[model samples]
Target: MDFKLTDEQVKLRKEFYDVCKDLEKRKPHGFAGLESIYDTDEGWEYHLYCAREYAKKGWISIGWPPEYGGKGTIGDKVFFAEARGYYDLPGIDIFGPEMLAPTLLGVGNEELNKRFLPGIASGEVQWCELWSEPNAGSDLASLTTSAVRKGNEYIINGQKIWSTGAHRAHWAFALVRTDPHAPKKQMGITFILFDMRTPGVTVKPLYYMDRAHVYNEVFLDDVHVPVENVVGQENEGWRVTQLLAGFERSSLGAIMMMLRQLEELVRYCNETKVGGKLLAHDPLIRNRLAQMACEIEALRCLGYRIADAQERNEMAGFEASGVHILASELQERLSWLGADILGPYGQVKRSRWSPFDGWYEKWYQQSFVLFIAMGTNEIQRNIISWYGLGLPRMK
Candidate 1:
């Protein structure tokens, strides 16, 4: 329950915030929104620029063990996330550093960690997830992607859709059916890593509604991966997948983004008048904003509790899923509120007509994606009900 930071953590957190604040000032001319991440080459390059900077300063290695070059705790990681999300900084990749490194620490061989951890920690490489497919998004265990093993390698052949950052990533960690004849759907699956530039690997764009190419459809045709790329046992990747999914869900970045958006909302309301009264003065807007504030605070508290549980090695609970569902749904709700407040102005960004530089406009369009990414909120709910509450399975 004690959420106070130690003096050292406080100093470290401020350093991270100062760096992000400075980056915000020095960002590219058109780098005001996440849209820049996918809509223009400048945006992409700007992201890489940020990535290298984070790598150089070791921000990317927060909370990792000292042996792995990490020099902070779980609290320090949360503090850094708030700064990154507040500034909406680019360059800190979620897939490679955030999701995979933790998974490796949990289940990978020393050699695997020694090989992959450095690239991610150094931010020299970027990674993507290859989990969902045309028909296996929510029902991920049913994924049909196959990685057939030979003596020394696995020949992977399948398709993965809705892969975020796949088009721009240097590598991917995929779940493939290594043994098709296993008795259960979740059994016999393998977690494998491979270079995106390998032969017969194709990445085609799957743009958002606003035509931004942040997600992609990755096709693998007889792609070959060395046995060393497998993270654990050849066919027991489900456990690692679950572990990684928990990390993805518990990531505090989304909550931090919502916190920043709330601040922007308050500022807009204070400055804008509607019907001869400031928007902040409207009862309905005030109520909605208040509700969002409550939800965000609760989410932040939950994040801290989860981090504490993780620190204690006592997080054998549904808190991760709970945080994911709350954060993603809250993001969607915030986006909708912003759109409703902005009215038509919310629909446009980078134009003089848009408020907040059309930042929420992009968020409004992509809001629903957050609920489904990492894993669907529906799935998270089911997990909470069945596992957390001990509810019986649905027929």
Candidate 2:
């Protein structure tokens, strides 16, 4: 594929970078890691501020269709994502724009998009995902979050764990079992959306080993959700879920963030002294950084390919898992390399002694999240082999 950018695309990307870099200067001091942006009230406020700023620029939904408040091409969406990652800005949740909006466009009625898309496009409503559970995270088909129909509404009662940003979200999209007695687990699932303020809904914060509060466990106790809120047919939610999952796995935002971290790591190596010389002069560190740069470029190109695929409107395929696996595992490896470079300073957190103000430390702590989130790396490999490569289907 030709990677050349047109003049208009170049201009758009530069404008996005300028705006995001300016926003970076305005963000709170201690905001570095992705979770740090949502872990505190100050951080959350900064996120909302950045979100509103980006919304004013109309940069949130550049890839959405023209009729749905989107005015830019898919290439523009890459610039927007790069801006977010370069600045570590918040307010862009995958559940809403990147994940749900695409699925809704594919299968939702006009009323659904008219009501929900506008809020998401404008960043008026933030969304959380409710797919993982205590026992059925990677094996989401076995999820037992049951939603029993009652007239015009469904009474949802179950628990969802590892729900990122649920504590701060105004809304959520979830997979619940609509037919408990179905012959197959995947056959009975239903995709539903509801207000986070529903009567029986409860969100409790779960901290990382480092004491961050970006993830939560959500309990739905008889939460009433109108049938109208279902994304597609009630018992046919699995198909809609598959559609959204494809979009979710196609995200390359984290890869851009890794690129940013790499820049910082290289700068650190240049300035920090070891054995009477800068770390950058060390042959071992130089080799490691070179290898990381190659991997990051590979992932970035994969991102470009996926974005190009989305541009063509032929995205209902199995390539997303392959992209997701390579990108997610690269995060872990990058963090590990950073940790090795920092030595004891890498383990330090928010301390005067920590290197790079404990950013690498926080990065190492949270990078493992990618492995588990959006399906485990093992699960993604299975999807790639069976769905994409067509090697074999699990019985």
Find the candidate with the highest lDDT and give its number. 2
Residues 19-67 of candidate 1: C-alpha lDDT, one tens digit per residue:
9999888677757545576567778888888888888888788888888
Off by over 4 Å in 1: 29-35, 248-251
TM-score of 2: 0.95
Query: How do all models score by TM-score?
Result: 0.94, 0.95
The C-alpha local distance difference test score for the whole of candidate 1 amounts to 0.83
Query: Which predicted model would earn the best TM-score?
Result: 2
The Cα error of candidate 2 at residue 222, in Å, is: 1.5
The per-residue C-alpha lDDT of model 2 at residue 81 equals 87
Q: What are the lDDT scores of the predictions, listed in order?
A: 0.83, 0.84
Q: How many clashes would you count in candidate 2? A: 0
Residue lDDT tens for model 2, 192-306: 8999999999999998887889899999999999999999998898888777655633356678788888999999999999779999999999999999999999888888888
